[model samples]
Target: MDFLENVVSKERTLNPEERVGEALRQAGVSITITSITDVFAFAIGATTRVPVLRSFCIYTTAGIFIVYVLTLIFMVPILSLDERRRDSGREGCLCLRLPADYKKNRCSQKLLLEVIFRRIFGPLLVKTPVKVVVVLLTMGLLGLNCWGLSGLKNDFDRTWFFNPGYQRDFVSAVQDLFPESGYRADFYLGNTDYFREKEALEELFNRLSALPGIKNGSIEFWHHSFLEYLKEKKGKPIRIMNVSTKAMQLTLTRRPPPMWICKQADILLNSVPPVGAMNHPGKISPGLQYMCANG
Candidate 1:
């Protein structure tokens, strides 16, 4: 082992791991090379069995499949950047960013491959070009996947969640009657006696909500987005309004509807504390719940 290490370690520019890899070549035996994508794919695929791994399956089959694929289209640039770095013969950004003494910097992908071969040694297959080709092919396949995703029949109608059957039909009929009136906002009104009385809360909540980026506000002339007020409303009457964007049936045809001007969006109620109960809106954080309940 020292003989091999001594042979490889003599290379001035090659990283230590790269040196070890060269030593392995002298010894013979190859292993398969893994790329960033392979790492991610395995990382994602493994998540199915290991619940912890699933945290990385960002590419879920949600809402619009085609759009999701299109979104993953961004992976192309990232992979390309990796390829460019590998070809330039410079250490990766990670290596450069690390403090000079970081061992991992010297243990580059190539060097690591060699070291593995020296230990378990089989001829290490899959080189830089192969990895790049694999990544490009995968991205292309993913792009084509967008077509199938786009074909998915998604009911993006605004009325469905709250009003189900007749509400859907009513919304459909309304669309026929006035295609321009498709936009709607939902305000989950929590009946708190506070807003009507707390002048400061009312004024602050109202003024900010009217501001852009804020979907809803509590009081008129106050600038508070509906989300901002969510934490503040603690057991108080809260009004959360959901705003609609242009993607609705017709952009200009719809406008933000005042409560009286339009039928308000549905009311979501939280009858219990946010954790543990079936009626709770948020999932129970078992870890936090344990610490809080027992501690």
Candidate 2:
């Protein structure tokens, strides 16, 4: 053939397979695009199969649908008008004069993508049994979700997110080691009038302590209201005490100066931990110390 390569000593015609491969390569048909698509399809398939990722896939697909709908609503008319103009031999932009060669190059890949999408979703959406099964399953799940939501509580138990293995082991260890004594819940109240409202505050504390979940006599308020404490003193001036805005501070500790647990408007209360199983510190990880300190 005229396309045969010439060597110094001899001339050899290229193999048919080699010639075809070369032509395909020059036309930009190569493994790179196919490999990318294969990998992407595998990843999407794998992700869609996972329970957690399936929701994300569904949401992303819905978002894509929304974008497509928006594009159709806003862009189809403009595109149709442009096509009409082009057919009528009217050009708006100089860039339109050049044929979009990239479209030709991507024809095979476009066809492949179209085929893959149709194969993936067409039968499931079109077939009677498949569609029925999908609808029934979706309705069943939706009903289950509604039933579950009906029992949802206002309080969130952060322990639900703890590692299962760690939680099981920790409960076993705690049950083995300290079956008699468990952790307690500490509640803090700020902006309290401890001294002036001692009776009311103490009543609230007693009521809280009496709750079946709270340990008996474990409830203790560290800060007594200054106004209330002063009123009890035998010789305290009634007028001065009534006029004064400050409360006396008392520290109860091992050192000479005990840490006053209360200031003018703040109060600290320490009590038995709430008796809920979820209140167990073992259920919380990484932030156990922070929860204990702040919660």
Candidate 3:
């Protein structure tokens, strides 16, 4: 306003009508949208330009609404599949155990009978075809979840993912760097910062490496080889191990030793907390299904 007023006042000789037109030009609208790709491109472009439109604010808003509505529309079937999956979970989390540990289970005999009846025949025999449809749909969804979803389901809900892809990619990257023979587990010497003593890595690696099947699965040093590379290039050889002390996050990784080797190494590096006063990043492991506790 000040700039326009200054220019308008610049000429007392100019007509008032002409000054009004000059001020109008200065306050004129602006628009920019050049890269239009497909049908989506044209829709974005044609609606954006308007007479005396400052920025096509309403069109932008409507565009956003359109996107939201489309997402919800496409997502409806996915949600229905999800509900079916929930119905299916009753079958999945439901384990048809042989009551072998029935004595240890909290449920009494009557309660156990009720559970079996509820889980098995309740849906299978009694429910209508629609419910059966839900069962089949759920089975299909779960199959997709396990086989197709990869870690994508976690993006939808964390609980759905078995383990984050961070673990998968990290493991794969490590495997690529240091080949895992064929073992399913790896030994980790993790602490805060994870690379406590650069040399300690070789110790644990060599120690765990001696284990037979573990040789097939690679041992990923949270720090060793990287340190050697770093130090060999005159970079950092050793740095303080930054253990996440507040939370006992025992950060470690190891290719699982053969079942036999694991039986032996439990003395040194099983799930037991290491002697360090500080806690390590705990409660997480690549193979969450296994009993190997710490790294």
- Each candidate's number of clashing pairs is 22, 6, 28
Q: Which candidate, 1 or 3, would have the higher TM-score against the true structure?
A: 1
Q: Which candidate would rank higher by TM-score, 1 or 2?
A: 2
Q: Model 2, 1-295: lDDT tens per residue?
A: 1121112114224343444334334432343455445545545754543444566655655555565556546554554455445444444685255454423345533556557668987756888998899999999999999999999986533344457788867765765696554444545554454345545655666566555555555544443233334445535544433432222222212111232433312333232222111111111111121122222
lDDT of 2: 0.45
lDDT of 1 at 200: 40
The residue-by-residue lDDT of candidate 1 on 1-295, one tens digit each, is 4434455447557644455456556643322122334445654564463343354444432323444344346543454454445435556656344444545534343556656887554433356776787799999999999988999894444443445677788767866796643343323223432222334434544443444533332222211322233334344554432212222112112332233122222212233222211121111111110111011
Which candidate has the highest TM-score of all?
2
Q: What lDDT would each prediction earn against the true structure? A: 0.40, 0.45, 0.43
Identify the runs in model 1 with alpha carbons over 4 angstroms from their true place: 1-143, 146-155, 159-164, 186-188, 194-196, 204-295
Candidate rank order under lDDT: 2, 3, 1
Q: Which of 2 and 3 is ahead in TM-score?
A: 2
Residue-wise C-alpha lDDT for candidate 3, range 1-295, written one tens digit per residue: 4334554558545454454446435543320122112334445554533422324544655566565556446643443443344333322244333333333334432456557878986768665886788889999999987886566642221223336577666655654685533325444334433333434545655666565434323454433443344345455454424323322224222332233243333223334344444224321112222223232
Q: TM-score, each model? A: 0.23, 0.32, 0.19
Alpha carbon lDDT of residue 74, candidate 1? 56
